[model samples]
Target: MTHQTLPTGSVSPEQAAREQSLVDEVVASFAGAESPRLRELMEALARHVHAFVRETRLTEEEWAAAIEFLTAVGHITDDKRQEFILLSDALGLSMQTITVNNEAVGAATEATVFGPFFVEGAPRIELGGDLAFGAKGQPCWVEGTVTDTEGRPLPGARIEVWEADEDGFYDVQYGDGRTAARAHLFTDDNGAYRFWAVTPTPYPIPHDGPVGQMLQAVGRSPMRASHLHFMVSAEGQRTLVTHIFVAGDDYLTHDSVFGVRDSLVRDFALQPAGTPTPDGRDLGDTEWTRTRFDIVLAPAQTASTS
Candidate 1:
């Protein structure tokens, strides 16, 4: 009798049946979930994760190493730094979540990552007030209008803005309990707003932790493109978290967090010292940059009651 050899990685019928049985059992465990959505999510998660393990033929040693890496990620996370967000951003999960949650509505502005550095209760600034608060960098004048999808002005919109200084460091990174380069201001009656912010410079995400190690292992850079962050919200509108990338930034194509969007890129025009400013704030012997970012908000999605 001649024996037929199976191809590489092929399992016999009995073994395949055993593997499938395990997956079924795991998925079945979620049947008792109180929420229908929770049950569905847990079951789907179990199936997909099991499929991944089966497809990869993942070894026990590799699973152990992954658990250890995740442990390190949790250990390094703190109020000042979020290692998990870095990991998600590095893996493109953050962007994927944003895409799933933020369906495009007409010409509404696109949304991006709500980076880990955002802090609550930021100081409120009046229109055209400076946001730098003495942080080091070239001065930039940021102006914009907030309007609805129909181009109607949305007055009283709240805009929260933050960015790393020229040296690629947020105020939170200094460990000195200081707040700079971050502020919140409201739109005026005309839905217009402006502020003095430092010109954003490209900077690396926090990469000293396990996420950084993972990126290094895959030969990836942790550099994010130069951009200013914004979180805009108005009554009866969906809140938007996004960034305005500086046009011509070298890292636009390879932003570590995958947060760059073509629509969000804007020109940061350089002005020679002594050029007349719109509001005329004097900067002796210092050149400045300016950019305009118009924001459009989508109508908030209402829950279906039917």
Candidate 2:
């Protein structure tokens, strides 16, 4: 929209202004929406959206392209693919929503965007069991403890873990629904959990749809940081959805999904081969890395119920 300066009293932008005002009145027509909150939200949404179009003087061609882009986004959504969530992550809206909806739960673990790859009903593994089905990355031993905000151990806490492998591919991406590089486990009496899995590596978000074109048009890369995801829950405490990013990953500062946090970044230390694993897994002198992540959960009512 060109801001043309006209001589004072020369001409009035009556047509454009009237169109914007008419849109507002149409929104006002919905003031009788059954729920007060819904009505309020709808009105606000309409006002801002309308204002944006008026302020930008959006072209009909641009609006038509937007409609086509949105249609492609919807067309690509499915049981295994979530194009909408990917879009939200790309726009940083997911992280913004997380920040706003979560209250100060007295120094509990900070939440991050739950990526589009999470799947339910992952096979349960015993303590110290291996989560890698066929991933070929270097072995990584992840150890963690579940504790309450007050530092009390939470025994039997359900800990679900998933991540992409060294090659930057999650199990679900194969489209076979295979269970690998992901598992669900429970904390022991001492509030500790351990598992054998591949080290996480930087990966590109799926970008073969309209999102890919959108990124190309905006000059943005789709690479995400290397990290392992963990979702911890207990009987009476709030669930913690977080990840541990590789401390020195190049993409950590530029994660496409904007899920990285300073507190969540940690070291994945390399250990000499033949070092015995805590779970008594016989690696037969194989080299492996280790990472320890301690999770703190607040009471269910104090935190966002994710």
TM-score of each: 0.93, 0.89
lDDT tens digits by residue: candidate 1, 1-306: 111222227777777677887888888888898998988788878877877787788899999999999999999988667788889999999999888788888999999999878889889999999999999999999999999999999999999999999999999889899999999999999999999999999999888899999989998999999999999999999989999999999999999989999999999999999998889899988999999999999898731221
Give the lDDT of residue 60 in candidate 2.
100
| Clashes per model (N, Cα, C within 3 A) | 0, 0
Q: Where does candidate 2 stray beyond 4 Å? A: 1-20, 304-306
lDDT of 2 by residue, 61-163 (tens): 9999999999999999987788998899899999988876666577688888888778899989998888887776889989989999899999999998999
Residue-level error in angstroms, candidate 1, position 77 = 2.4
Which model scores highest in lDDT?
1
User: Considering summed lDDT, which 10 consecutive residues are worst modelled in model 2?
Assistant: 1-10
